[model samples]
Target: MRDEIKGIRPPSNPAAIKDALDDIARIRGRPLVYPFIGSGRGRGALVELADGSVKWDWITSIGTHFFGHGDPEMTRAVLTVASADVPIQGHLQPNGEYVEFLRAVSSIAPGRCKHVWPSMSGTMANENALKIIRQRHAPAFRVLAFENAFAGRSALMSEISGSAANKKGQPDMGQAHPVPFYDPADASSVDRTVAAMDDAFKKHPGEFCAMHVELVQGEGGFRDAPREFFQAVFERCRRERVAVWVDEIQTFGRIGEYFMLTRLGLEEWADVVTIGKMLCGSAVLFSSEYNPDPGLVSGTFAGYTAGLALGAHVIRRLRADGLIGLQGKIRALERAVSERLQVWKSDRLIRDYTAVGAMAAFTPIEPDLDSIRSMVRKIFDAGVCVYYTGHGPYRIRVLLPGGCMSTDELKEGFDIMERCL
Candidate 1:
């Protein structure tokens, strides 16, 4: 462990932090939950803020920094690409780094996904996937999405997302239809989902083009279902001739597998998939059958040169470091965190403890949005930064940096959480 991560302490420069927060709030039109301003320096899972206080970053930028902050390997990758002639790569003229990134991702992609399209963000990748599906099955514009699914924030994606708040004030595209996700508490959960899917197909008849599966719902409180449920859903889509699109944007590298579908043994059913966050850059992977025409999907910027290099390096390191199987380091961390959470649940400190690989979440005993938000703020103030997900009964979501976070550091974070509770 590094010296800065030894322990957490109060901010030394409160006035300076307050000034910076004020400036940021004035410019952004809203105050943040915590006055967090990074000092651009970190070691392992610990980051130093502008106020000279270091905290354990359990959320890892919502799963973007899988290797944690200031990873030496990632730093070297970025530096190697810094001298590129152009800062950003584009569709018309891509550099060698772009091709390298595609090859790196392709090396791990399912055999069905033979074609790849690069994009700047997850939303763009999802947009490209939607377009390819739509073009392949024209006039069949409707989509099948889970009730609490969160695709992205683009115009089409916002409409497709299951949150009404996200689609507020925007005209309803009426393109996405909802189906209930699996509930472990219900004995007939699998059958119930299949029935709902069947009803949608019957009602819409050939109007549906694809089904979006999150595998492990990120914004939906890290909730996940068993493989049996997914197999049933995929079978229904197959019978209906509706394409299966897996959105692994948030679950890609953190789920103890390069792709969650592969882990579930459902990769063969996936026609198109989108990945991002932990990959540094986002991309859409599809089968040759769904490949779009030349003029259908094109973007000005693929991504930054350094970002592509860093993404490729992350993938390579993940494979070489033995961090990607069912018995990998990611799963080991998940088990450690789940054990601590179980103790808290038994003690009545929390409820609904849910975990998969590096992602874990639990709802507070109170189970209200305001109360959960308060708990998150308290945890951040106590030296570990975590965020909340879902509504009705929000959960405190924990996303660990699977590649670098150690067991001892993880214990320290749970100790802080216990103290806060």
Candidate 2:
């Protein structure tokens, strides 16, 4: 695409690749996806084009590769670990890398939370959180999840998220009501809507096992929870005797001290914290020190060599290299993007703006098919990547990892985005 790109394969025909994938999609079901991203590339964080052009990645697997794709440091660990011949599904034999990952993660993720379980994905991690919550408060069938919360696609998680559409038609869709992410942006909204959650609990009696929350609701359009509000919720959950679960899958490590929960001082408050995306850089890490028993739950690829090795490398790098406290970098980026977008707000292309740590977002006033198409197409053509969330035409999200991008690179990407708006 750019005369010649550095450090990647010669590239394959994305159209041909698309055609093959299209056939698979026919059976895969045509779910409407947001624009900006075409199909992702094989290794590098580039979106492969039909003409073989590539665009920079913004989503980063919804904030998955914290360090970056194709990081040589991670590769070294992967290559060395694959030489082993143990059956990872054995469940009982979690190797040195797995043990090392857990130990480091426990030490790094708010010392108050000293336990973690390896699972397959963000959804699995969420499921584990749900399981842990119920077990901790057995008779409590309910769990408090915010309105636009985006957990994952498991049967339980889908229900908890209140996105029944995602479930499509799953038989046992567990129930969790939507609490307003708060309406500072919505003018006609009456009152400072914080009771949306309390309203839910009133409808359904003491069945709640916990209040599963995200310090930053990334999928719900990058909403930030007031720190005091989180503290209040923790105090209430204590009174209700419900477990507190924080979905750190999307927010942890984007910035702040390792896990997002710690940013809210939720380390001591959270009874269980679920982490995925960049947790071990690949595998899902769930904590259940107060709740895990041998066969209560497990995943086929839990702490496999590949994921553990990659995760270990990522964890080790953060500790050894001081990559965890990059909050200043995030603040600067948020200021740059928000200031630029504000000028365009009157143009009505933007509906809202918000930021938490390095996780950033802005939204369309009225998100529709054509509106989404125009914004994403322009961003893609200009060579940046982003994604969508919520049942609403939520926002354009950008993930700034420690090394995958430079301040200038992210700035340049946003400069192109400004022109697109």
Candidate 3:
């Protein structure tokens, strides 16, 4: 299996594939972020590009494809749904697969999470969560989000997101207050952040409906918000009556245990949790107290039937296999990677590294976005596909495929990364 997957090659006419991709990008009036093009062909951790080039996909569809691409079980679940001939829409007409998916999700959710509302993507899930917060806490339209945090790119979500660039031309969708996230390396970060949250409440007294946070920030450069920090913030939110909404969109299935919040022991305080990406679907899990009335959060398409089915399967496996949690395989994999990163700490080029759960980033000593981009391109040229994130001090982040890779496979990937560097 390894030989077959590793031997996969790029398309004979790589340039033609890139040209076609460029043409399509131009037609769409958008530039390609990465020159790479997908061929819709992938097996395990490898993806075949339109150019016929097969590269080890470290991004894993940006943290989707938890079990890697084209898993037999996922494919079978999808095929069964496809063969059913029933309509894919689940809001008006509930699908058995979607029902199972919700059950699985609700079971793993720390709090009651008695109410589950499915959406098509992470952004929609977050948007719907915000709607729920508004419905439950009427007259409170403002939101509290952390700086460098990412919610999504939808109209409302763009404003909620930390990046101003995502909402550059977009009109304001909601009242958002961005506070600094906790940086353990910074001695006074927690105190300052807590103070900021307090100030936001005072400035907009009774105006905030929800406090949205990514326990382990993903697109915001894979940073972690310490337990003490979260505890402190949650205390303030509780006092202010602001609903705590944990956005596990990127860190859900990939993180330690079932969810990052749960891993951090903060689920008890979270009123609503939005999850998506590798779960095969997205949904908002809220306490019964926050559950909205009918029509408050309903969508035409709850989720893809196949994806819903596969999502249920994925959740079941994660629960049964014990790949998460404190002593879980995922945690072990994270430790392994952390240890490997230490070997490069002494190297002058590598400034530092940060990881939480399956997400990690290697920071350079002297940061340069263009240099990191060049490194990524060179890494791709070296036959290992990876990506970079964050601005100014960009990092070569690793979203590991733990479900598919063993210790040896992971070490091999690390070795490849080192060679590329």
On TM-score, the leading prediction is 1
- The C-alpha lDDT values of all candidates are 0.88, 0.65, 0.81
Q: Determine which window of 10 residues in candidate 2 has minimal summed lDDT.
A: 31-40
lDDT of 2 by residue, 326-382 (tens): 444444555665666676676676877776666777777767646665677678778
Residue-wise C-alpha lDDT for candidate 1, range 1-421, written one tens digit per residue: 4455434454457887888899889999998877678777678888878777788988888766778888888889989989989899998999999999999998888859978888989999999999999999998999999988989999999877877788889998789988999999899999898999989888989999999989998887678999999999999999999999999999888888888998898889999999998888899999999999888998789999998887888889888999989789988988898899999989999876888888889988887888888999999999988998885678899888888988999999999999988
TM-score of 1: 0.96
In model 1, which residue pairs have backbone atoms overlapping below 3 Å? none
TM-score of candidate 2 versus the correct structure, residues matched by position? 0.85
- List, residue by residue over 144-225, the lDDT tens digit for candidate 3: 9998879999878888887768889988765888999887778999899989998998998899998999888787777886
lDDT (C-alpha) at residue 26 in model 1: 94
Order of the predicted models by TM-score, top scorer first: 1, 3, 2
Flag regions of model 2 displaced more than 4 Å: 1-15, 31-51, 86-90, 170-174, 185-205, 280-289, 326-332, 342-349
* Model 3 TM-score, all chains together: 0.94
lDDT of 3 at 304: 79
How far does residue 397 in candidate 3 sit from its true spot (Å)? 1.1
